[model samples]
Target: MASQNDHFASIDIGSHTIRLLVARSNEKLEIYPLRLERRITRLARNFQEGQTLKTPGIRESLRVLEEYAGILKCHGVSDVACGATGVVRKAGNGEEFLAEVRQKTGIAAEILSETSEALLSAKGVLSVIPRTEGYILSFDLGGSSTEFLLLDTRREKPLWHTSVFIGAATITERFLSEDPPPLEAVSRAVEAIQDALAPVFQAIGSILPAPPTPFPLQVVGTAGTATTLAAMNLKMTDYCPSRINGLPLTENWLTATIEHLVRSTLALRREIPGLEAGREDIIPAGALIVREILRGLKQTHLIVSDAGLLEGLLLDLIEKKYGRPQALVSPLTWRMQKG
Candidate 1:
């Protein structure tokens, strides 16, 4: 078995960003992060229109991955897992892209299915929150899709999970034409989000008690969209992930933020304290999607989690190498849920 000193790394190549996580485990098998990096390459840019990743997007992703691989090598990472989500899964030429990526970067990028993305995201959130008395519902909003996981500690694993096609990049491309989108564009985007979330709402409503009955639920939000929102809420001149993680954002704040974002021009939004350079255009759609989710799900507040799929990937490596760590093994294992 690998000892406490073993270094490990995880790479998550998503539609809008590429991230890397490097960590080392302690005696108890709990890992501590050494470095976390995110580079916005917009891998899904023009993918819907072109049906293939654009050349500039592919080149940028390769550059980022090559740098990440070098970082892993320098750290002498003993175990590494890399995966691509949403964009790669949808692109018709995704396999060809992956081949070129592997040949250039020496990192095998597995394309994760929607279900796999959901589970990994859940694992990532649970790794941080551990357990909640009531049921926990978490969402990972990506550039191309939003993944959901409902975990009921009373049960063994997640009660249910799903992936909706509505996402920041896709919605922005489909609904909004002008920067600081006009009222009509905003309405269309909101309607699209509602339509996408209808089935999820239906499923949850059927499972929960009728209105006026208090639902035993807590909502958690993960991935880029949620964390970025938390950063913006704090209005930090320099975003600190430590402050963002486990932060609670109220529905009122989310609604207000959406209004602010939708009304602001892309240039103005880019000037926001925590807004990143490349996300100015798509953040309005992302903010709106988050607000609708809070309202539709009857969630008053959302706990923001910075630890997500990358963290989950590291935990999975630990579980596979050593017997499952207590932090990782739920009342129900992920494999059992599949069976």
Candidate 2:
């Protein structure tokens, strides 16, 4: 078994950003989150016409990884797990890129398949929420792809899952071509999303047994897009998951919020309550993608989950090494690190 003081880290190399989390696990099976960092590298932005990560994208990714490596060292991280999503999974040169990243960062990076990504995301959301006995939909919207999974809380397992190529960053680049996009541009984007989601919806429909009654489905959204929306809904001057997570956001409020965002300029988005500076440029695109997903699912409300792949990965590692938690990592540790 890994030692109590051994430091473990997980790095999520995503299309829009790279995130690293460092934690220490104790003999009592508690894990304390120590450090968190994120860098916006836009690794998928330069993908060539054939869906290959361009030379420039690889170079930028390497630079970001080198920086993250330094941070890990400072935190005394010994065991590392890293994964790439979306662009790398689809790129022809993905394997080659992964090799280069490992060489430069001294961290082996695995490219997760679509189904595995969906499962991990679902696991992360479920880890935080109260266990219920109904169907739960978990969605993670990254820069280049969005993953959807249907979890059966009754059975405590994922039932159906799929990954869609449309995501906040890519869709924005594809559809919101205009600054404060024209109404037509917005419509086109929505239409495109609807078309792309049709197959997924049908696939889900085939797998899910008809509801015995009209039960209100619980929806959990993770990743930056969801967190941004939740923060905006709360009108928080500063981001706080304690205030935002699991908060019930009604459909009317979400619609109103989206409409308000669509009318504002990027500069103005930064000034708005709950909107973070790093998210200002992409929030509009994210809003559109989220709004369309809700519309497609006919969902009126969703619970935001700040916990995601990182937390999921941590849980898996802990369980494999030491079984279920006898004691949780100190909440004080989380507060201090988050602050």
Best model per lDDT: 1
Deviation in Å, model 2, residue 147 alpha carbon: 0.8
**In candidate 2, what are the lDDT values of residues 119-168, reduced to their tens digit?**
77776677666667677888999988899998766564577888988887
What clash pairs does model 1 have? none
Q: Candidate 1, TM-score vs. the true structure?
A: 0.92
Model 2 regions lying over 4 Å from their true place:
46-49, 211-215, 323-339
TM-score of each: 0.92, 0.90
Candidate 2: Cα lDDT at 58? 82
Full-model lDDT for every candidate: 0.82, 0.76
Leading candidate by TM-score: 1
